[model samples]
Target: MLDLLEADRAFVAENEAQILDLEAQITARQRWIDLLRDAQRAAKQRLSSYKYPVLTLPNEILGEIFMHFLPPYPDPPPLVGNLSPICLTHVCRRWRDVACKTPSLWRAIELHPSVHRLSNLGETLSLIAKWSARSGHSPLSIRMECRRQFDPISIFTSLIPHRARWEHLNLNFGSGSYIQTLDIDRPMPLLRSLTLTVWDAVGTPLPLLEVPLLRTVVINDQGSPSLVLPWSQLTSLTLRRTHPGACLSILREASQLLECRLHLWSQRTPLGGGAVVLPRLESLVFERDSEVCREFFESLVTPALRRLELPEAFLRPHDVETLKAYISKSGCTLQSLRVTALASLIQQILYRMAFRSIPTITFCE
Candidate 1:
C-alpha cells in the first residue's frame, strides 16, 4: 500500500508541469478572446451610429412592410400614434416622410368615435381630412364604430369627400349613437367590400345598392328590411344571427355567390319552400346542424360546391344520406366536408355513401 501511494504521488508530480503549461495556454487564449470581444463590440457601436439595415431599405419596400403590419382584409385597423403603420411614422423624420408619402399606408382609416371628444368635432374632421389627403388618389378602406353621436354634419362632410375613393367600408353603430340613418349619395364605382352592423336602423336603407363593382357583403342583424344590397353582384356573403328564411330570400337573389356563410339562430318558421340555384357556389359554412340546415342544403343547387363545414352540430345517418344525395344531384365534386358530433357513429355511417368524388372528411366533437 505504501509503494502504491508513492507511485501515485510520482504520477501527480510528473503531470504538474504539463498541467501548468496547459493552464497558461488557456489563459492566453481567453485573453485573446476578451480582446476580440471588445473590438467586436466597439465595431458594433460604431456601426450603430449609421442608419440601420432596415432603414436603408427602399421606400417601396418599407411601404410593403407597413402594409403587412395592418390587419388582413375584412378587419378594421387601428389609427393610433402607438400602433403599427401609425407608430412607423413616429420613429424618425425619414420614416414619417415615407409613411406619409406611401398612399396605401393611409388608405385604411378607422374612426373610433369614442376617442374624439364632442367639443373637438371640427378638429377631428380637420384631422380626418388631413389623413385622407395623405392617401392621394389611392382607393380607401374606412371603418367607423362609435357609441355616441358626433355632429353628423362634420363627420359625414369629412368622410363624404372621400366617397369616390372608397373601396371597402365597415360601419359599426352602437346604441345611443343617434346615427339611425345612413345615406351615401355618391356612386361607389370602386367599392368592392362592405360590412355593416347597424343597430336601430331608423330611416331608409343606405343608397348603395347599385354599386357596380361591389362583390363582398357581410351583415349581422335580425333582418334589415331598410337595407338593400345588389345581391346578384355579390360573390361572397356572410349573415350571422339572422333568420334562415331571410337568408334563403337573399340567396334567391344572390345567384352569383361563390362562397356563403350563414350563422343563423334557431328559426321558428321553416324557410319558405323554394330552391335557389347557386351555380358558382364553391364553399358553404353553417354554424350548426338542424332540420333547417338540412332543408337549406337541400334547397341549394350548387354545381360548384367543394367545401362544406357544419361545426358543433348533430347529423344523423339519414341527414348524411340527404347531404350525399344533394351532392349527387348538384353533380359537384366534393373536396372537403367537416361536421362536429359527440358520437362517431354517424361518421362511420357516412362512409357508406358511395360518393363519386371521395372527399377529405373531418369529424369534430
Candidate 2:
C-alpha cells in the first residue's frame, strides 16, 4: 500500500510542474502580444497621417475653414443633412470635437416648416436645443417660417429661453394667432434687425421696446399695425401692402429714417395729419398698383432727399407744376428721379424737357 501511494504522489508532482511551465509561457507571450499591439497602433497612426494630410492641419485653420463652410453671418445654414454644420460632427471624433468647440458655427438657426417634416418636430427641436447650447453665449440669428398646421410655439419655445442673445429675428407665420402666443416681450439688448410677416390680422400688439440696437425693420401687410417698435431709432424701413394712413402713422415716429420704401394698398383712410419731415431721409420709393394720392406725395417733407421714385399719376391735374412745386417745397437737390408713366409719349417728353435741370430722369411705362 505504501509503494502505491508513492507512485501516485510522484505523478501528482509531475502534473503540477507541467502546469507551472505552461503558465510561465503564457505570461511571456502576453508581454510580446502587448508590444505587438503598441507597434501596430503606431504604424497605423503614421500610415493614416500620410493618407489624410488634411488631418495634419492645425485645429485653428480647420476651424476657420469650417466658418467659411457656413453661409455668411445673419444668414443661417440648413438644420440637418450634408449642408448643415451638424454633418461635420458625424465625420470623426476629431471633427466632432472641433465643430462643437466652434460656437459661431451653431449661432444661426432656421426652423422652417418646409425644410423639416412635421413628424420630426420633436427631433428637430432636440437638435435645435443642442445646437443652441453649442453656440455658447454668441448672439443668435433665428429665422422661423411656420405654416398654419405647424405650431410655431414648439420651436419658438426652445428659442424664447435664448431670447437675450437674439440679434436678428424673422418670424413668418401663416396664421396671426401664432404671433400672439410668441411671448417675445422680454428685453433683447442685442436685437438689431426684425422682419415680421403674417397672413392674418393680429389683434395683439407685438411690443419690442427693449431693443436699443434695432436699426432695420421690415413689416408686411397685416403686421404693420401689430408691432410697437422704437421707430425713431430706425435707419431703414420697408412697409409692404400697408395702407397710406398706416405708413404715415409709422413715419410720424421714424424721424431718423435714411431710406424708406412704402407699397401702398388702400387710400380710403384720410391723411388727416400734417406733413412728416424726415430731416435725414435720402432715398424714398413709393409703389402702388394704382395711382397714389397727390396728398400722399405732398404729405412727406424730405429736405435731404436725393432719390425719388413714384408713379406719374401722383402728380395729376398738373405734372410739371406739381413736380416743380414738390422740389421747391422740399428744398432738396434732386440727383435722380424715376417715374412710372401711363400717359402719352408727349406727356413723358414734357417731363424730360421740364426736368432737364435734374441729373438723371427715368420713365417706366
Candidate 3:
C-alpha cells in the first residue's frame, strides 16, 4: 500500500510540473499575440497617417516637378530615367500620367556599346530612336560611348539624322581606333557643351566640329592622337590625362577661355609654352603636376584672372614665395586664392604676406 501511494505522489508531481510548464508556454504565447496585435494596429494607423495624398495639382505643375528631376544633359546614365518609372509612377495615377507625359525624362539617350552586345545593337538603336521621337522638337543630348569590340563608326552614322537637334554631345571611345572618317559637316548649331574621351590612335587632320554656342569642353585621352578644338565661344576647358600636344591644340582653339582645369600626367611634357594668353580667364586649377604650374606661370599673361589653385604636393617653400612675389609684382586682380600645399609652405606664404594685407588666402591641406 505504501508503494502504491508513493507511485501516485510521483505521478501527481510529474503532472503538476507539466501543467506549470504548459501554463508558462501559454502565457508566453498570449503575450506574443498581444504584442503582435498592438504592432499591427500601430502600423495600420501610421500607414493611414503617412500615406501620400491624391495629388490635385494640374498636369503642367506636375510635369514641371518631374522635369526638375530630368538631367540637363540628355546622355546621362541609363539609370537616369529608371527612378521615375519605379517610384514616381507608383505614387499615384496623377503622378504616373505626369511622369509618362514628361518627355524630357526620357529625352536623355545613352548608347553604351560596352553594356550592349552586337546582337543587341539593333534594339539599342531602336530605343534611342524611340526616345528621340518622343522628345519631339526639343533639343536632345546624345552620349555615345563604345568599347573596342563595338564599331563606333556604325553607331555614329546610325544617329546622324538627329545630329542637328543635339544640344550636348559626349563621345567616349574606349579601346577602339579613333574615328577617321566622321562627317560632322552638318552643324550642331545648338550644341552648348561637348565631352570627348579618346583611347586609340587618332590620325592627322582632326575632325572639324562647328559648335557655335559651345561653352564647356572636356577632353580625356588615354592613347589617342591629339584632339583639335575649333570652338570660338568656349568659356570653360578641362584637360585630363592628355599629351602636351593635345593641351596645346586645346589652348590654341579656345581663345576666349574663362575657366581652365589642367590635369597633367607625370610622363607628358608641360603645356603653355608659346604666347598662349587667356585674355578673360577667371579661374585656373592645376592638379597633380607642379611642372605644369611652373610652365603656366612662365607663359601666363591673363589680365582678368581672379582665382588660382595649385597642387598640394607641388607647393614648395620657394614656389609659394615665387607665387606671392609674382602676385605682388603683376598687380594681379586676384580676389580668391586657394593653395593646396603643405603646412610649412602655407606658413612661409603667411610670413611673407605679413607686410601687405591683401586678399584672404585659403589653404587646403
Q: Please, what is the TM-score per model?
A: 0.75, 0.79, 0.71
lDDT of each: 0.73, 0.86, 0.66
Cα deviation of 131, candidate 2, in Å: 1.7
Off by over 4 Å in 1: 1-57, 73-76, 115-123, 149-156, 175-181, 289-293, 311-317, 345-356
Best by TM-score: 2
**Which has the higher lDDT value, candidate number 2 or candidate number 3?**
2
- Per-residue lDDT tens digits for candidate 3, residues 92-208, read 776776776777766667777555343555665666665666567777777787754556676677777877777888887754344555565457888888788876654563544
Q: Write the per-residue lDDT of candidate 2 for residues 213-251, one digit (tens) a residue.
A: 999998887776566788999999998888777788889
lDDT of 1 by residue, 196-272 (tens): 77655565454455589999988876224446778888999988767778778888899999999887756676776
The better-scoring model by lDDT among 1 and 3 is 1
What lDDT is obtained when candidate 3 is compared to the true structure? Answer: 0.66
Report residue 177 deviation for candidate 3 (angstroms): 3.5
Report the Cα lDDT for candidate 2.
0.86
Q: Pick out the ten consecutive residues of candidate 1 with the lowest summed lDDT.
A: 174-183
